[model samples]
Target: MVDVEFRVVSDRRDGLLLALGQTVIAAGFTLLRQRMVNSEEGVVLTMVVRGPENGLLLLEERLGTHHLVNSFEASPVDASVANAVSAPAAAAPAPAPAARSNGGAPKPASDDAATAMDTRRVEALLPQLARDYPNIFIQLLALEHDLPPAQREATLRYVGQRVGTWVYKRDFSLGGHLALADAVRHIALPAMRQLVQAELQDDTLRIKNSPFCHRGEHGSSCHFLRGMLGGLLGGPHGTEGLRVVESHCRNTGAEACCFEFHA
Candidate 1:
């Protein structure tokens, strides 16, 4: 048997270890040691196991495609590494450095500033958002006012992606993978209804009275919505190369905001 170590990053801790344990057993591995810790990246789970050398590929594939796994790294275990497993878990990996723009300057704050919403903060607010769904616009408007005009949409989009991914993990990560249209209908539409009036027809999602986009205005206010849809539908288990495009916006003379999902 060969020993391998896996480090997994996920948005939530609940059921993650259990699910992973099952996957490991099914992949013909014997769990040797594991560790989990809270971090800015969400939950980091490190596991060491022993299995047939040939099973490494299958194990990696399963972990990579797991809906709960945002990212993971696997490496063969060695003597020094195995010794370290007895020590306290190391800190979660630091987040990747922000991408630099032209001239080696950092991107705009809105593009790469600290995430607008982290997993913990979103988890804390979800119940309240569900309870007072209609009043969420007030909070959203407040969030808009706090951001610079140049940064508003980008910041909102970042928050949208975070929240969207969280919602998918919490609600839709179970059962099995879903196709683009089914996910849009079964996952996106219902999740959106909590915050906006949305209907799915064909491959387009129509939104009425978006809190962010006011009638008669001529600007894009659906950046957050676009980001949310992207997060919900663009993961490994979801549809790959899925794009959410806002074809029409109420602010731009449309009766509603029409977001087209192209897979």
Candidate 2:
């Protein structure tokens, strides 16, 4: 059995984690063991990955592609953990028609169709958002709460985030619902949740020992465990604001999604 390992220290307590599961998803890798430790220097992350070498390379590319690695001081992964993380999640790719938690499934998008619109969905969503409202989408991403399951794909399919209007060329990926939710919900999220909650519960531990909770944190740090939503929007950083607005735009485009905000 091929295995790979990485012991990484980040100056930021939780760098790359926001995008870690997402990275695993985009590269189609399976997460084995993931632990984050808070030390004097910063956050220390250890991950076990199992997948094809090509797939692993793909993930490395995304680490750079998504700015996840730059979020911290990432070192080259040891071969064992690298091999482990590179192995595919399933012997076969999850057959299309990915299921929704509600026992529903989306019609399999055709192979010819773009997976997440080759990043164009983000390309379109954020610039238009800048055109309409600046600092909103990024602020929304800062919220721990994600777009509700019902609206996640649709909303993500229409939006993006970038540094500036003309600089909209750099956009956060507005895709990966099927992969992110599934990967974390089953494999990664459980442990990540435990680690964060343990830190929060230990009142003796302050600041340095705490995981950074997004915006106005509720009872839970992990969104899926107890959910990350906060009281129908209208809180600091508007943690639940995006989800509240996204509800009306089910399967709609950005213009339609945005108009609902004003209308």
Candidate 3:
């Protein structure tokens, strides 16, 4: 195994860390330490990772091609420093306290705050999801089982938004601005078909055999699809403030999952 230090610069910081981290893992490396800072150039990310010596080339290729990365440099770490950092720690650290406000008071948490999606975990599995396509119900089943019942719907929705935004930025952002119906037909429908069987009819989109709720046993499991639609259709470059509603779901004994769009 070899240890390497990487410095990456990006135009934005919104999901820079998560995106780069996903690329690193996909290229077969384990992240050891990381730091981020904003500079005149942009968002700078410095990370140390360990992986097979032969993996460097593949890692470089992945980093260079990543959509979120503007430029990056990677170099082998000095043996002594790598060993020192890799050594077992003397003791475990104490748990971190809640963050404080500028006034030094603990801030109360808001239930309305959107649940944080585990982008690293979700992105890592995205390739597998795409590769397997419509036959990916086993993976969706695992995700359904893993999440807590109370937060499952919200988490799936958030994941959908993340995935949808990612797809839009990666695929459709370069084109001219389109109207809602055009965007839905040209952008959203194609994107949706990548994961499920979907067809847009008028203002309604019907999804046949959605992997998330195909079994007809779970109670309305189309939260992710609904959230994805919101992300795809409501972005600034697309149509803003568009709403997606799940009118019918196979999980509720409907033949297909139906979504209605409203501006």
Which candidate number would show the highest lDDT if scored against the true structure?
3
Report the Cα lDDT for residue 253, model 3. 84
What's model 2's TM-score?
Answer: 0.31
Q: List the residue pairs that clash in candidate 3.
A: none
Sequence-dependent TM-score of model 3: 0.52
Candidate 2, run of 10 with poorest lDDT? 254-263
lDDT of each: 0.69, 0.34, 0.69
TM-scores, all candidates, are: 0.50, 0.31, 0.52
| Distance from true location, Cα of 169 in model 1, Å | 1.2
TM-score ranking, high to low:
3, 1, 2
Ranked by lDDT from best down, the candidates are 3, 1, 2
lDDT of 3: 0.69
For residues 48-120, could you state the per-residue lDDT of candidate 1 as single tens digits? 8777899899999999999999999988898466656523333422222224667663233343434443334
Q: Of the candidates numbered 1 and 3, which has the greater lDDT value?
A: 3
Error of 1 at 189 (Å): 0.9
